[model samples]
Target: MRTPAQNAHLALLLEVAGTPKPGNVDRHRDLEDLRFEHFLAGAVGAQRGLEQAANGGAVGPAFERSVEGMAAQGGGNTQFGALLLLVPLVRAAADDLSQPVVEAICEDTTVADAAGFYRAFDHVDVFVGEPPAEMEPLDVRRGSDAVPALEERGLTLLDIMEQSVPGDDVAREWVRGFERSFVAAERLAEADGPLTERAAAVFLSLLAERPDTLVATRSGEAVAQEVTERAAELVERNALETDRKIVERFADELVERGVNPGTTADITAAGLFIALERGAITV
Candidate 1:
């Protein structure tokens, strides 16, 4: 049986290898600034941190290390949100992969974990929304410089995630018990065909279910809703099974618009890890 860390690594690789996830950097598509090879390098570089999480290391340090290693490649930020979701899940998987267990793991995070999370921003340029006026001093974009404020507030990693929920789908998983990730895992497990095909199908389903926060931040709420509606239409038409060219065309249009549903991809990576851990997906 593979370890959780190995499964997490494979999850990252498989997520990228899944073809034509609209506006995502998949095997058949690459954004102007990011490439498939960069994702490969990130997955490789992140092994140490994944291993750390599997070994029951501290969430903050392991996450920081993962981000640092992921940023070792030329790509600015390939999988920050994915790693954010993976770290706690990997830790929980080391014991029990239940919602309560995962919630407890997140709840156990310390102020130091918050510091490590802040430090991670120094390694790469992760796109994030501005903090509220009152919390401007603790803005994540401030990077390690915000650590002191985080310390003064005695904010844990979970606390930071709570604060980020309004603008970040990934962070909402932390606050809301990872409902989407777990649901996607079940969908992936029950789906037919190769893992990549299942991943693509799940990716579309997720995009259809909700507007990607990354899309909203990068484009606008209107654009994000449009992308979600488009995905919903494709899913309704059974395009993944019947007419893949239609999905490909949608992918092409999103790429042209420079709109990336990155948060959906991140959740998919977390779901892949869960499926792998549960033996819902076997290597």
Candidate 2:
């Protein structure tokens, strides 16, 4: 049986997915793609939440308890519910795109990685004229055999979304309009100069602080040790630096609003998780 919270989350995903919008093809596709990607990332994050909970890792005990309670109630069914809501949105968004984009994605090694490409594609806007005169006619084909499970999973999501948000015409319209203006991927990739430098700087600042908290907050000695090691690896690879500055700035801004700087890690983690839960982040 689905918990009330899980049901509510499914309803929310459906509501967002059904948001209304104008009929422009580009805009409609963009919004649908983004909303779908956001929901998928949320599902991934939720599953990760369960893993982190079971391991008694770095997340707050309160959060772990919540996951435990949810799992106890119905055996992690919410994750499946989330998947049921995600598939139709993916198909609706992808069906209209150019073949090259779809082919490029299908060839990726993992479904998650391919899905990530679609998430990026949602923010890309390019105008390519009809196929070049010198090129042979495009031989596009759906390679369902390549990733049958992923394709089936995506379709299942579509079915769930359809069932949950059947009559919300207004929300659907909004989504259509939002998609038209979406430009996240292009903005992230092509932006130049000091902005990139600043993001790198911010990442480094946060990476420096993460290890201490990972060691202190994790419940199990082994988990703490693992997190500590992971944090070190992140620093060595400069993995967090890209987003560190933005995170720090965001943290500072929150502090200015009366949030305690001493609680920065907890607050940051909470905010990030909330965004994940709410489908604000596409990946």
Candidate 3:
């Protein structure tokens, strides 16, 4: 059996290799600076940290190491959002993959976890919404400079995520007990076809269900909602040829418009990780 950390590694590889994820990086899709190879290296490099998290390690240090590895390869935030979810989920899988256990692990996060979270920011160019003009010292863009403020206030990572939940989906997952991720994992488990195709379906299903927060941040809620509606329509299409045409066309249009449904992609990765851990999908 694959270890939980190894499952994380396989899930990342499967996620990136799942082609035509519609504006997200997949085997067939490559952004200007980020490619499938970078993502592959990132996933492989991150396994050590993810495994450590499964082995009853500290959350902050796990993030620190995983982000460092991802930065060394991708040199940007290729999987930062997914890393946030994977750390907690992998930890939970070690004992039992349930809400209460996961909640406890998240609830037990410390100020050091918050500090490590900020430190991970030091290495990546994560695309995000702009911070307020007058920043809190804890503003993530401040990087390590925010650590001192975290210490002064004794704010745990969970506390910081609670503050950010409204504006950030990843933070919302942490604070909301990963409801969306769990939902997506359920969808994934019931999906048909090859694992990659199942993953692609899950990715689009999630995009259709909600306006991707990353897309909303980049292009406003109106654009995000419109994209989501189009995805939903495509999902309901009866003919495979029509669906393919729609997805292909939308993929081109989204990239052209700089609309990446990255939050959906991250959620899909979390679902895949869960499926892998549960043996619902095998290597």
Candidate 4:
């Protein structure tokens, strides 16, 4: 039996190993600043913190440690959001793999967990949208500098995620009992073929289902919607199974345009972890 930490590590590897992930780095694709090998290195480096989470460490600290380790590689922020989801999920898996279990783990987060989450930003470059005028003082870009404000507000990690939920899909997952991750796990379980291929197909399904927030942040909301529309069309045609070149072409176009559906990739990683722990996906 594989440990949750081991499965988490494998989830990272498999996510990146799934080819043609549309603008994201994968076995057959790489962005200018990110590469396939960097992701591989990141997965290896993230093992320590993953183990900590599996050992029942606090979510914030384990997540910060994971980001620190992931950043030890040349790739910057290869799996920050993914680890944000994985730490809590790994902790939940240590006990039980259910929505309520994970939700409780997230809701149990403390102000210190919020502090550690902010500190993780110190280790790498994560592109986040600007905070609302009222929340500026709590902006993630402030990193540890925002801790005082967070402390004053008595904001826990879950609280922080709730504040961010309107704008960030990953944050939405945290506050919503990881609903999308669980849904994706179901999709993975129902899909056929190699796990890697299932991941790729699921990646497309996710992209088609929602506009990637990273794309909206990097490009624009218009562009993000357009990307989603294109993916939906491809998926409707069953391109992933019947005509892979069509999917690869879309991936190529996105790569050339420098538009990465990073948030979608992060969700895919989280879903893979859930599926692994549930025995829906096995190594």
Q: Count of backbone clashes for each model?
A: 0, 24, 0, 0
lDDT of 2 by residue, 176-198 (tens): 32121122212222323332232
TM-scores for candidates 1 onward, in order: 0.99, 0.20, 0.95, 0.98
lDDT of every model, 2 decimals: 0.94, 0.28, 0.84, 0.92
Residue 114, model 2: Cα distance from true site in angstroms: 28
lDDT ranking of the models:
1, 4, 3, 2
Best candidate according to TM-score: 1
Tell me which residue pairs clash in candidate 3: none
Better of 1 and 3 by lDDT: 1
Best-fitting candidate, scored by lDDT: 1
**Which of the two, 2 or 3, has more TM-score?**
3
User: 112-209, model 1: which lDDT tens digit per residue?
Assistant: 99999999999999888767899999999999999999899999999999988777999999998998999999999999988998999999999999
lDDT of 3 at 132: 67
Q: Arrange candidates by TM-score, descending.
A: 1, 4, 3, 2
Cα RMSD (Å) between model 3 and the true structure?
1.6
State how far residue 185 of model 4 sits from its true place (Å): 1.1
Global lDDT of model 4: 0.92
lDDT of 3 at 261: 88
